[model samples]
Target chain A: MKTDSEIIITLSDVWKSFGTQTVLKGINLSVIDGKTTIIVGPSGQGKSLILKHILGLIKPDRGQVLFEGKDINAIQKKELNEIRTKIGVLFQNAALFDSMTVFDNVALPLREKTVASESEVREVVDEKLSLMDLRGSNDKYPAQLSGGMKKRVGLARALVLNPRIVFFDEPTTGLDVALSNEIYRFFFKTQEKLKYTAVIVSHDVPKIFKLADYVALISDGVIQDCLSPEDFQMSSNPIIKNFVEATMGTIYSSEAMEV
Target chain B: MLNFVEKLGAYVLYYVNEAGRMGIFLFFSLLNIIKPPYNKIASVLKQIYVIGSLSVFVIIFTGAFTGMVLGLQGYNTLTKFGAEGLLGSAVALSLIRELGPVLSALMVTGRAGSAICAEIGIMRISEQIDALECMAIDPYKFIMAPKFIAGIISMPLLTALFDVIGIFGGYAVGVGLLGGNAGAFFSSMQSDVEFIDVYMGFVKSVCFGLLIVWLCAAKGYYVHLERKGGFGAEGVSNVTTSAVVLTSVSILVMDYFITSMLI
Candidate 1:
C-alpha cells in the first residue's frame, strides 16, 4: 500500500447517481503519485465514472475528489482548468477531429493554449508524433487511419502538452491481440521514458496487470480491494478473486500474474 | 387516457425546458459575441463561408422564383381593377419586406442550421467537446460563439442580396413578359417603398439569424444531456428536426410581432 505522502488523488466517500439509478455509493480510492494505477472492474461498474470525477469532468452528488492536495470540486473553473492542463485523457474512440490532419490534431493544444509560433508548434508535434511512432501518418486525416493508428495519434495528441499525468480509457478494447500487445508495450515504454503518472480504466486484465503498480478492484459502487497485482491474485476478498478468476480463467498461471 | 395526458404533459415540459435553455444560451452568446482575444477567427470565417457564401446560389434560385410568382400574381390581381401600375409597388414591397428575409431565413435554416446541428451533435457524441474541456479550453467560446457571430453577420447581407435579385426577377416578369410600362414599374417602386420598410426587413433578417444559430447550436450542445434517449444517430436526427422546425415557426411568429410593432 502507498503511504499518505505519495498519494496524488484521493476520493473521499464519493457518491454519484444518475436519475434514480445509483451508480456509485461511498467510493473511496487513493491513487499514488508517479505510479501506474489500473482501475479494473466489470463493465458498467462505475470505473469510468471515478476517472471523470478525478478529472473534474463530472462532480459527485456528495463528497470530495482531491487532486494534488486540493479539493477539485470546490475549486474555481479557472483553477480547475489550470490543474487539467497537467493531465491528459485518451478517449476510447481517439476523438481525433475528422476535419483535421493528424499533424493539426496534435498541434491543436499548443496552438490554443500557448503563443508558440507555427514552426515551434510543428517541431513539438513532430517530436510527439515520432514518439508515438506515427511519423509518416501526419498528413492523413483520422478516417484514413486504422484503429491502432488512431489510438497512437490520439496518444500523441494527449502527450503533445507533455502532461504530468495521463489517463487511458480502454486503450486495448477493440484491437486484436497482437495490436493490443503492441499498445501495451508502447504504453510501458513511453510511461517509463516520460515518467508520467498513469491512471488507466480498462478491462483487459492479464495483460494490463503486467503494467500496474497498484491494481484497484471496484464493484457495486465501492472499492472492493486495492493491492499489487500479485496480492490481488491471492486476495480472499470474493469480489477481487472473482474478478481475477473471471478474467484469467480458474487454471491461471500465477507467473502471468506478476507486476 | 391518463397515460396519454401524462405523455402530453411530459412533452410540453420537455419543450418548455428546451426553450428556457435556448434563451439562456443566446443570452450568454450575445454577451461574448464580440469579446476579443478572439482565438477562433479561423473557425468564425469558416462558418461565414459555409453559411453565407456557399448559400448564395440557393438564395438566388429561391429569390427569383418567388419574385416571378409575385409579379405574375400581383399583375393579374391589379389589372382586374385597371390598377396594374401598383404591381411594381406590390412586387417591391413583397420581395423586400416579406420574401427576402423570411424565405432566405427559412432556406438558411434548412441548409445551414441542420448542418450545424448535425456537426455539433456528432462532436458531442464523439467526446470532442469533452476533450476540449480536458485541455483547459472553453468549448463554448471555441465552438459556439464563432458560429453565432458568423450567422448574425451573414444574415442581413444575404437578405439584402435576396431582395435585390428578387426585385430584378419581378422586373423581368412584370415589364418584359407581361408588357407593364417599364417607367411606371420602376417609378412606383421608388416612390412607394420607404426606408423604414427596408430597415424593418433587415431587422427581421438579423433576428432570424440569431434565432436559427441559437436554436441549432443549443440543440446540438445539449443533445448529449437530452433525456429522451438522445444517443446514436436517432438522437442527432431528433435534434436536427427540432432545430429546423422551431426555426421556421419562430421566424414567422417574430416577424408578425415585429411588423405589428413597427407599423
Candidate 2:
C-alpha cells in the first residue's frame, strides 16, 4: 500500500442530488496513489455518482473535488481536458464506442488527445491489448465480445493512456464467479505493472477485501465508514456485519436484521 | 372549460422551456465554432454527408412533382385569356421565389433534422455524451458543429437544386408535352424571373437549416436530465418527437416572415 502523503484524489464534504432525491451527502474520502481503494455499498447508494464526480463527468452540487490537491471544478474546459487526459474510467456496462472497432476503441483517446505518431498508437494499442489478453480480437466490435472480454477491452482502453488514476464502476457486475475472479486478477496485475491509483466500486465483498488496501462503505446517502479491509472485517457495526454475512447467506447473530 | 385552458397553458409552458434549453445549446455551439480545437475536416465532411448527400433525392423528387403540378394548373388558368405561354413563367416564379426552398427545407427537416436529434438524443441517454465530456472532448465541437455546418451548406444547395429541377419539370410539361413552343415558354420564364428571387430563396433555406439543426440537437441534449427520474428509451423517444414537431413548426413560422421581407 502507498503512503498518505501520496494521496492522488480528495473529496471534502461533497454533496450531489438529482432534483428532490439526494444521491450523495457530505461524502469525504481520499484515494492514495499506487493502491486500490474499493467502495462497497448497497445498490442505489450513490457509489456510481461518487465515481462520476471523481471523473469530473458531473460536478458536485456543493463542496470540492480535488485531483492532486487542486479544485477540479474551477479549471477551464481546456485545462479540464488536460486533467482528463491523465485519468481513465471503466464504466459498469463498459461504455465502449459502438461506432468503433475494438482496436479503434482503444486507440480513440490516443488519437484524439495525444500527438502520438500512427506507429506509436499502433504499438501502444497492441501492447495494451496483449496485456489484457485481447491480442487476437482487435478487429472485433464490442457486441462481438463476451461480457468478460468487454470488461478487459474496457480495461485496455483505460490503461492505453497510462493514466495516473483508473476508476472501475462495478467491474465484475453480471459476470460468472470464475470470470469475476479473472477480472480481479487482471486488475491486480495491471496495478502492479503500472503502479497507478485504482478506485473501484463493487459489491463483491470477498474480491474487494482481497484487492483493496482501503474500503469505504456507503449507505443512505452518506459514507458510513472508511477503514482498512482487516479493520472493516473486525468491526462490530451491524450494518457491515449484515452485508458481509448476507453475501454468503449466513446470519452472524439471531438478533441482527438483514440489510 | 377550465380544464381545457389549464391543459393549453401547460403545453405553452412546456414549449417555452424547450425553446429556452435550445437557445442555451445554440449559444454554446456558436461559441465553440468561433473558438479553437476545431476538428475542421471531420466537421465539414459530416455536414456534407448528413446535410448534403442525404437530402438530394428527396428535394429533387419533391421539386419535380411540384413543378409539374404547377405547370398543369397554370396552363388551365391561363388558357381562358390565351396566355398558355405564361404557364412556364408562373411555375418558375412560384418555385424559385417561395415553394422550392420552403418545401425542401421541410423535407430535409423531416429526414435529416429528426435523425440528428434522434442520434444525439440516444447518445445523451446512453451516456456517450458524458463519455466524451470525461475524455475532455467538447460535445459541441465533436457533435453539433458538423451538423450545424452541414445544415447551412446543405439547405441552400438543396434549395438551388430544387429550383433547377422544378423549372425543368415545368419546361417538360409546358413545352415538350403540352405542345407549347419551347422558345416562347422559356422566353417567358427567363423574362419574368430575376436573380433576386433565387437569392431570397437561398437566404430563407440557410436560415431554416440553422434553426432546425440547432433546435433539434439542443432539445435532445438538455431534455435528458429533466427526464432522469423516468430516463430510458421512452424519454428519448418523447424528446425526439418534440424536436421534430417543434422544428417543423418553427421553420414554417420563420419562413412567413423571411418571405414577406424578401418579397
* Candidate with maximal DockQ: 1
- Those runs of model 2 whose alpha carbons end farther than 4 Å from true positions after fitting are A1-4, A248-259, B1-17, B226-230
Candidate 1 chain A weakest ten by summed lDDT? A250-259
Task: Report the lDDT tens digits of candidate 1 across residue range B1-263.
Answer: 99999889988988798779878887877766666567466888998998999889999999888888888888888899998898789999998888899999999999999998999898888888888988997877888888888898999999999888888888889888999888998889999999998998989999998889998888888897686777889999998898799888989999899899877
TM-scores for all candidates: the values are 0.95, 0.91
Model 1 chain B weakest lDDT span, ten residues long? B31-40
Q: What is the CAPRI rating of model 2's predicted complex?
A: medium
iRMS, model 2 (angstroms):
1.2
- Best of the candidates, TM-score: 1
Q: Quote the true-contact fraction of every model.
A: 0.91, 0.50
Count clashing residue pairs per candidate.
0, 0
Look at candidate 2 and tell me the lDDT of residue B116. 82
Cα lDDT tens digits for candidate 2, B90-163: 88889988898789988988898778877777777767777777777788987888788788888898988998
